[model samples]
Target: MYRAPRGTSDILPREQAYWRYIEQKVVNACQLYGYERIDAPAFEDTKLFSRSVGEDTDIVEKQMYTFEDRGGNKITLRPEGTAPVCRAYLEHGLHNLPQPVKLYYIASIFRYERPQAGRYRQHYQFGFEAIGDDDPALDAEVIDMAWQFFQSLNLRHLSLQLNSIGCKKCRPGYLAILKDYYASHTRDLCSDCKTRLKRNPLRLLDCKKPQCQQIANSAPRSIDYLCPQCDEHFNRVKRYLELLDLPFAVNHRLVRGLDYYTRTVFEIQPEVEGAQTTLGGGGRYDDLIEELGGKPTPALGFAAGIERIILNLKKQNVPIPPLPRPQVFIAHIGDKARDEAIKLAAALRKNGIGVIEAIGNKSLKAQLRQANTLGAHHTVIIGEQEVKTGTVILRDMTTAQQRTIPIVQLQEELR
Candidate 1:
């Protein structure tokens, strides 16, 4: 039998309630922060990510699903959300309308990576972006919004890891220092870190290999070398976060694995036993807009993996609101009863009553069983006698008590 491809899984009906709960909570939080929703194309010109996400990053270099279309254009399914949103901002001239365009999106992102427990080839992301502003307060606000979203879900033991990767001015100097430091320990570095040392030295800091991770932990920190402006910006962002009562730790080794990120970088991870998984992360990509051919615009954003959040919720045994139960089930026993049941079901639905029908089930016992399985509040029974008398029996499934009412009064009675 054919099956879903590797790194992907079907989101069956049984699991949809959890998704809806997360989406609704995210939407409500975005609204609370004055962030309007925006959606960009699922795929875009391959150059969009190559330029914005950075050429050396794993997402652009390996993970992106790139292909040539019928038009001979290099297109790629979006590996991440922020780049496409920024492309939309530049394409639509959002820069002219406002100083900072605040937007949020719950979108599907594609990445060709190993399908692990909370990771997938096709995943959903809840992302928020604020473009055209350089205020440190914007950085704090974006982090605050992410925190509030998790708080809304009642996710426990979430800790924020914060860092500063500096900007163009101070970063080059830091890279020089980092390269020199890594040069002395070249023999101990992983193969990837060796290449990173020559290409993008900062990436070495985020390497997951145990040896590289150990070296990174002792490496020189970017915060200590931040330019005056970057230092002040980082300090203000922390001060704002404290003012908002959001706690975070300065993780010197937390260099986000993106080329465009400058200054503030952070990740949110739950303190779980055995391999702490990051729920989400993002940073200030102040130069991304300009790199993508738009005028210079300082932007900051964050994205959370919906799948990871759901897994954490399940792990914590957090309660998710149950799906709505059908209020009325229409069961018919004869041809005339089936016809009458269809009409009654329509009328009840039009009047804002939730109705489920089992007109195909000829046996009343089977029909009642189906209603019980659905946890319906009430079951409407129509038979030859009821059809002839223009009446129907409404059974309260919970109490197992039923009563006959005139067909004309059924709608009002259900309400």
Candidate 2:
């Protein structure tokens, strides 16, 4: 009578093959890019997010899943991956290892926002981050990685959008322009956008509210106001992208929601997701390391929601992988045969052969039926008659043709 907890989903067995397929591609791609995998806890000190993600953002202000532990310590289920990864980088002293600490993560992140199709409170994210070194090539490399990651997944029609919001140099002035620009239309903007106008005017441009989006249509663009250094850096990033033969577009209004991002922000949006949705986005957050109590460093990275990617895949009618069929099924009769089947199962497992059997299957006919239902490629029958002879019968479930073979030769014979 009970249902799943709100805002959660079960990755059921019938659909797990596709999940594994996507995950395997990610793991392989990460290795190809020289990114070592690191896992941070699902939950962390609540203050980590409050400080790192900014207290004023919706993630901390309205969407975090914070709770008090029995010890009265406040902890929160991580709403995003970067903060936890940064915490681990600092705590474990990864900075001393090398110039750029390259890392990738595939994990579930929690947020307490409204759930909708392709959007969930609990969902998976595939993230990559590169810390250290401020070279423009690094920015291009991060953007390239995002592009290649999606391309490898066969996701098409995604446009890479890039921008630089300037460092401390001219950032405040741009914010002021944005504030001044929005102040005039404050009465026409959404209430949330109006409130954001007073707090972080830059956020008003990011608002998804209908009227806010309409109001921001003519807002001052950030790239036009970038200081000389920021302009040069952004140009260099674009130059590198061209060198790599990658295509991209400049979107000056591309301000990522997080406060840590300082320069060179970008997103990979599916052309089909339209106004209300995007695949994923991230940008340079050079000051994050300094705030995390590490030496000042320029960093840039991006993350994509795995669920949204899968959703798009489904929408495109891309094939979901078929469930794996057992390569061999062991059917046994009597105690001796059962014992032999158990030994055979272990040996097959050691050799990386997938086998399935009900250890307690009481009848030969029943076992065969179960084996056929499981779509096993072959059925290996061990009965008292065959056990005494030190041989087993291998039956092709599909063809109904079988041959008996010595138990010791079973592995090779099947192969």
Candidate 3:
């Protein structure tokens, strides 16, 4: 038997409660924020990601699942959400409709990586994007939405780590200073950080290795080197966040993994000691639209791993509302009763009642046991006598008390 590929697992029936819960919360949150839903293809041209997410980023350089299609075109499974949303925004002329197009998506993201707890090769993500505007207030709204989303989940002890990585203009200067500082620590740098120093210096601060983190800690802070415009933008974003009373801290080493990020970058993570799990994060990507051949458009977005959220929910012992299941089961004792049970099942379903009819000739006792196991609220028994009399026996699964009722009254009795 073939198993699911490495780094992937089946989301079994018993696991759906968590998924449904998170999905409902996601939909409700988006609706409250006026974010309409948008979905993009599972895969896109390989160049789309390389262009928008940056050539040197791990997503493009290492993790992306790129392959040639039948047409011999290079295609890549989407490794992230924001680029695809931006692509759709540009392709569909959404920019023509309004100044800011607020959109949300729940999509499966694929990457070739070593899977760990709560991380998978093909995992689902819930993300929302606000494209076509650059107001600091909008940034705050996006961050606030992210923070409040976790709050709505009732996940406790989450910290919002905020930072400004400066825009393209001032970032180069910061990178120069950063590279100069790391120049002396070349021997102490990790092999990856050594390469990052050459290709993507900002990612050095994002390094997790102990020694690299120490080097990043003492490195030049990006916010300190922001240009005048970026400085003002950072300040206003803070003021707006403060106005909303969001608890946030300025983390100097909080540069996000994406190259498109600029100015305000932030992440929300659980506050457990020695644990660095980020529930979600996003920041301003002011240059990405123009980079993708569209006119200059400032956009920002936040994405959280559904698996990670479910993991955290389980960790916190949060309660999840179970998905609705069949509440009534119909059991039969004979062929005539089986036919009647089928008809009754259909009638109940048509009347908007959920009923599970017995299948494949089970004993009445066995059928009732199945109903009890399924947590059915009531079981309707249609034996030969009941079918002849046009009546049914309804048993309360919880109380074990049963009564004979006319077939027409079954719906009302179940209700």
Candidate 4:
């Protein structure tokens, strides 16, 4: 039998409630922060990510699903959200409208990676992007927003890891220092780190291989070599986070894997044991817009993996709000009653009553069973007699008590 491709899973009906809950919570948080919703195409010109995400990063180099289209354009399913949002910002002249365009999106992101417990090839991301601002407060606000999102879900033991990877002014010096430091230990570095050192030395700091990680932990930190301006920006971001009463730890080794990031980078990680898993993260990609052919604009944003959020929620056993049940179920016994049932359901719906119709079931017992399964507040029973009398029996599923009512008053009775 054919199955869903690897690293992808179906979001069945039973699991939809959780997904909806996350979407609603994230959207509410975005609205609370005065962010408008914006959506971009599912795929874009392959060069969009190649330049914005960085040519040397794993996302653009390997993970992106790039292919030629019928018109011979190099297209790629978005590997991440921020780039596309930035592309839209530049394309639609959002920069012309406002200094900083605050936007949020709950979008599907694709990455061809090994499937793990909560990691998938195709996952949904709740992302927030604020473009055209360089205020350190924006950095803290974005961090606070991400913290508030996880807290809104009632997640526990979350820790914020913050760092500064400097900017163009001071980063080149840091890279030289990092290269020199890694040069002596080249024999011990992983093959990827070796190549990373030659091309993008900062990437060596984010290598996941155990040997590379060991070397990376002892390697020179970017924060130590930050330019005077970058140092002040980093300090202000931390101060703002503290002013907001958001606790964060300084992780010198926390260089975000994106090329667009500058000055401040961070991740919100769950404090669980075993392998560390980041719930979500993003940093100040101040140069991304300019790199993608737009005028120079400073922007910051964060994105959380919805699948990982759901996993953590389940792991913590946090109570998820149950899906709403039908207020009334319409069960019919005969052809005439089924017809009446349909009409009654439609009328009740028009009047703002939630109704479920089980007209296909011929037996009353079966219809009531389906009503009970649906957790309907009331089951409206119609038979040949009731149809002829222009009435329905409204059964309260919760109490298993029912009473006959005139069809004309059905709306009021159910309400």
Which ten residues in a row are the worst by lDDT in model 1? 271-280
TM-score of each model, in listed order: 0.97, 0.92, 0.97, 0.95
Candidate 4 local lDDT, 1-415, one digit each (tens): 9999999999998898899899989988998898999988899999999988888888888898999999999999999999999999988899987677899998999999988887788999989999999999999999999999889988999999999999999999998999999998999988988888888887788888999889999999999999999999999999999899998999988877778888889999999964538889989988889998899999999998999988888889988998887778889888888889888888888888888899565588888888888888888889999988888888888888889888898877765
Q: Candidate 4 versus the native: TM-score?
A: 0.95
> What tens digits encode model 1's per-residue C-alpha lDDT throughout 1-415?
9899998889999999999999999999989998999989999999998988888788988999999999999999999999999988988899987778999999999999988788899999999999999999999999999988999999999999999999999999999999999999999998988998998888788898998888999999999999999999999999999999998999998877778899999999998964538899999999999988898899999999999999999999999999787788999998989999898888888888989999565589999999999989899999999999999998999999999999898878777
Q: Model 2 misses residue 49 by how many Å?
A: 1.0
* Candidate 3 segments whose C-alpha is farther than 4 A from its true place: 273-276
TM-score of 1: 0.97
Better of 1 and 4 by TM-score: 1
Q: Name the regions of candidate 1 deviating beyond 4 angstroms.
A: 208-211, 274-276
Range of the 10 consecutive residues with the lowest summed lDDT in candidate 3: 270-279
Model 3 pairs in collision? none
lDDT of 2: 0.85
Model 2 residue 386 CA deviation (Å) reads 2.8
Ranking 1 against 2 by TM-score, winner: 1
lDDT by candidate, in order shown:
0.91, 0.85, 0.91, 0.89
Question: Cα-based RMSD of the predictions, in order?
Answer: 1.4, 2.3, 1.3, 1.7
